[model samples]
Target: MDKLLITRGVQRSPFWKFILWILPWAMLLAWGLYGAYLCLAEGLNQTNMDNRFAFGLWIYLDLTVIAFGAGAFFTGFLLYILKRHELKSVINSAVVLGLICYSGAIVVLMVDVGQPLRAWFTFWHPNVHSMLTEVTFCLTLYLTVLILEYAPIVMKNRQIRKVPSYLVFEFNLHKLMVVFAGVGAFLSFFHQGSLGGLYGVLRGRPFAFREDLGIWPSTFFLFVLSAMAAGPSFVLLTTWLVEKLSKKRLVKRETMSYLGKLSGVMLIIYILFKSVDTLIWINSTSPSSGFPAFEYYDRAAFGTWVLFAEVVLFGLLPALVLLRKKLRERMVWLIPSAVFVLAGVALNRFVLTIQTLALPTLVFDEFLSYMPSWQEVATFSMVIAYGVLLYSLSFRYLHLFPQERELTQPY
Candidate 1:
């Protein structure tokens, strides 16, 4: 079965070894499913959320993965639109990663919504004034685009492509890929910005509220830039990890360096704008609302260090490292820089989702903190396990890396 399913000329681990490798992830997935089941069967009571702290770990996960998943649309934009042909080496992998991340985010959101059965209300009764409505529409539409983009890859499998109909279908799908890529990028741009705008429009939460840049707040554009910056780095990191685990050269050194360079250039742009946004908020936005911006960081846990880490340490440091040609070429430096960029994105999401909810908004309100229940942690772990399992299966069966055969074989 493995032999028939595996792509021709691509080396995969023995069937038994492969089974052993996936066993843990499979178990983790099952455990996570059980946790999700409990949440659905029981209710919102299963988690530690309440009226004041409606957003929790699950919301954070949704935002973070969606940001990381930006690789799919951004990579497609680079390859199909910009004519950066070198990106072909990792485009399929990017699509798969995008599918996993976006789908996982939707699943988590379903659970977080509490009334999963009534989730369609967003579409049935739309709210034209809400950023969430835009986010909902764009996320669903972009996910559909990712699925369509991924179809050709799935159809190109060893046994699947043998069928004449499937072969023709894949060939035709290949022709329409650029259109899907364009649509996906368009959808992703709106949703990513809307997610940030969701926080920025929270007038009740001065820590999150920002002055409108025209109609949208500063966070709106900032989120888009951050996602674009983080996307390629995530793709590069995942590709490197796959290479290490499989003990194979999946892509060329130049491809990896190119991804790093792209990420660095975007990161620098994002950081510059982000710094300006922060300064504006501190000097004008928060103060105008009668809340001192620095006072928001007076809490011991949510201190000034978090801002420093997000902006300077994770943000500026990684951008500098990846922009340097010599440093990005080295695996040690490149990998850590990618990690930092991702961390910066995650930290930004955390501050927006968790810290915003945790802080006191009213004059007499006390500082509050909330932690995830076991159910939340398990459900979160489920998404990671799901991504690993899916990527492993895709790598074993699909031609994710175009350069693999040439890099490994003697011509």
Candidate 2:
């Protein structure tokens, strides 16, 4: 009876319907896999990325997803450390999402690197001063933290729980979850911050350069703050999408509202710091490097609009929208506002990656534009498909939502 009931807990769709739902995503995933093959077999030449733009769409996606994915650690911290009991209702979903985001970013990084087979040379050669090394180290360690945090959820599956030893193991692991969450928080703080530091440390790229605050650049903290601001917003949007697709209330509206409010406050704080950082970069940092601020904007490839789009459209608009009580209460306003927050982060990534490369550092340097080849897009799309597929499977197999059985009482 327990096994039977457990099977029932897994969502049931007609086989044809499941096929229909997954077919398009599956095709896209396959195309991405083919792209991955080309990347591996043919080499890095397959993409538009070059020596100047070594960190292209893949790096942008990795950082943006990981930054947004910080909700996993932050949510875990709230539930396990701070004892915000309300978050327990949605913690599992956060962990699953984090797993997808972090793991997927790692996978993409593996493919994005040249000589992926020799990737370990990063650790072996160890440019200790390089921000990328810190990113690599912390990211991998934090991924372990995420896996550990997620293991108990997998173990809670009725079939798994039925095994007595596994039950005890999971229970023990759950007891130690706070430790794992703490480790995740620690690792997340550094890497998310360091991802921004990656751009900030580029003294050559004045567009990305920032005035140093002690040893770290201002963008370091700004990145972490921006990530925290955007992280919960992404979670809210993802949960809303899941609810729409599944046609069920996964998380209560109150919880969603709380997350939005938190995001709004953080967004405002981040924008303030960002504004300061941008001003400092333009006035003190860029000019010192003998580059005019507006000179970074290319007439053909990048216009001044990128600046307004990132700061105003992506930054202020969503921050203002989500911050308001009346706006947040209205689902119509809130959902798109969360989307704008997402767009802002994505735009942030684009400017950091593409714009940095587009600007000519030397007078002799030529203007450059890069469109991610189909290979790059396909591989990137695979990350989304994989996340969707994993999240779908997790939702079906695990008790992702505590509210599900309570609200629906699936019997």
Clashes of 1: 0
**Pairs in clash, predicted candidate 1:** none
Off by over 4 Å in 1: none
Give me the runs in candidate 2 sitting further than 4 Å from their true place.
Answer: 1-12, 409-411
How many pairs in model 2 have backbone atoms within 3 A of each other, for residues 3 or more apart or on separate chains, i.e. clashes? 0
How many angstroms is residue 15 displaced in model 2 relative to the true structure, after the best TM-score fit? 4.1
TM-score of 1: 0.99
Candidate number with greatest lDDT: 1
Q: All candidates' lDDT scores? A: 0.94, 0.84
lDDT (Cα, tens digit) per residue for candidate 1, span 290-398: 9989999999999999999999999999999999999999999999999999999999999999999989988889888898999999999999999999999999999
lDDT of 2 by residue, 21-53 (tens): 878888889999999889989999999888877
- As a whole number from 0 to 100, the lDDT of residue 281 in candidate 1 is 92
TM-score of each: 0.99, 0.94
